[model samples]
Target: MKSSAATDNSSHHVKCDKNNINDDGNNSFIELPPNSRPLEHQIAGHFYDQSKTKYGLLQHSNGDVLKPLLNPPRGPCEEQFYIDVFCQTSKSKYNSEDLINLRKFLPHYLGTYKCQKMSYIILENIIQPFKHPCITDIKIGRITYDKEANEEKIHRMSKNSVVAEIGFQLSGWKIYRSKYYEYHDKRCVRSLNKTDILHGIAYFYGAPIHLRLDVIELVINKLNELQDYMKQQHTFVLISSSLMVVYEGDDNDQELNKSTFVDVRLIDFAHVFPQTNSNQSDENFLFGLANYIDYMKQLLDKNYVYVPIDKFEHDNKTDTKIYSCYKQLLT
Candidate 1:
């Protein structure tokens, strides 16, 4: 519901009229509607960094999202990745089950949009189905920096040592509870221990017991589907990507729609690259997925009380059965 203020970068300015967008041959690239605004609930990726851009995703009038392409190779690489997965043609070579089934776990790619010499990738808004959505962005993979990372970038990422310890990090989350939303940004979890992270996850799915059970179970099922796809493929090394978990946060019984209750999708593919060799799967991504799944299963197995984050901060020594779930990670 928020609009990004006009930035110094002219490329980011929306200057398209209906005719300019509609004339892009075959009508594949649609124009940004006048009402399009920056997505307010975005949790992860470059969007949150003030210097990256004052804007992130623009929610279109048709309920889709317009994601601006980053500069250079990162932009082109992401565009090509989507094209190879979705726009299958006679000349394309990325048709493996790994790539094909990606649709099951990723936002549907509509097409590319170019306006005033700037480009954007249009994708289905993953949260469109929910009334009030509780969302979390979990960055996957232990080795987040790719071979392309410069020394400075590598040094910066290395400082967040939790990624190497647990194979993933709870980058950010926005939860709706008691008619209000609580947000924890990426910086909050960077230095957290494995136990504190577990508490954070607990706080994420902090719905009423009955609703919490259903949401966690469904989310776990979705993760399993992604896990199955990741295990069988040795195609791309997904780096610095994230698993976006969203669920309906409107707890009213009448508003609860089981069909649209929870959704999971893979997001942020700027660093995704083909594997060095055909025989090796992306173990780094799989390891993170596996660890997250284990944590969810433990939640289902035990009735662990959901501790409010503020309470956890003051008295983290709460002896709940949930802490026993990932004893290995803590040690």
Candidate 2:
């Protein structure tokens, strides 16, 4: 995830026109009613050949924009597995647990369909409610900071003040060392340690340092909870992904006010191995998680100054326990 899964297809009746390809021989988007192009994005073709296919938001003229994806499932069974998972995990066991951490780990899985050489999953186009929202999207990967694009991001975020400005949108996941090391620019993040494993961490929005600490703490707690849940449920094995931390909201507001929106989610599921048919360890989640916290602590210091509970209490009136979880995750 450079800041998301697979499923069955025979059951669903859908088709893609293979003839609808561009002159480049790469696949083009399926022929459909003409729609508006994305506000600012590349029109990437969708024919994944073990190559990283670019995923973008399908902004439609009808004002219905959605996050689009192209990736293979773990196998034929992959699609159905997540469909069931999404169904079971759709709503909380109790309304009171609406803020349950289970749903917080991944983007809202809208649904999926198949076409020529690709399986597309539709997810909630994660956008802020603000008229002009600034987004900082980071795709977490198994690469260390020294050898991946993360180094550039770190440098840019640290020195650039506009990164924190309102109306800024920060989106994109971390780079993969094994898969992306060669094809992607050298500036991408890579594993610096002798071992090839890289843990995931957030920038804490860079330079400011204090805010970085708060963001990192929240991220750690979220990862801790998610890692624990995955192990218990045995849902799936995350191999290599550009998982990300999304922060959106007005900047001028108090720190906690930013709590209106902050999420930790896997960007894509290209390397996700379903545990249903395999014996993959959930260790990757835990390992990456701990590594992320440690990496940040070494740079920003481990001590955390309390982000008052009242900061988010305003938004979580009905879910006071969630507010408690926020405070506890930090402590």
The lDDT for every candidate, in the order shown, is 0.70, 0.39
What are the runs in model 1 whose C-alpha is more than 4 Å off? Answer: 1-33, 90-93, 207-211, 303-308, 311-331
Per-prediction TM-score: 0.80, 0.50
Candidate 1 structure quality by residue, lDDT tens digits, 52-133: 3433567777676778786789887887777667655445445456677786677877776666545778777888778778
Worst 10 residues of 2 by lDDT: 177-186
- Model 1 accuracy (lDDT, Cα): 0.70
Each candidate's number of clashing pairs is 0, 41
lDDT string, candidate 2, 221-288, tens digits: 67677656655654455543444554442344554465545566654445444455434445545555
RMSD (Å) per prediction: 10.3, 15.3
**Candidate 1 root-mean-square deviation in Å:** 10.3
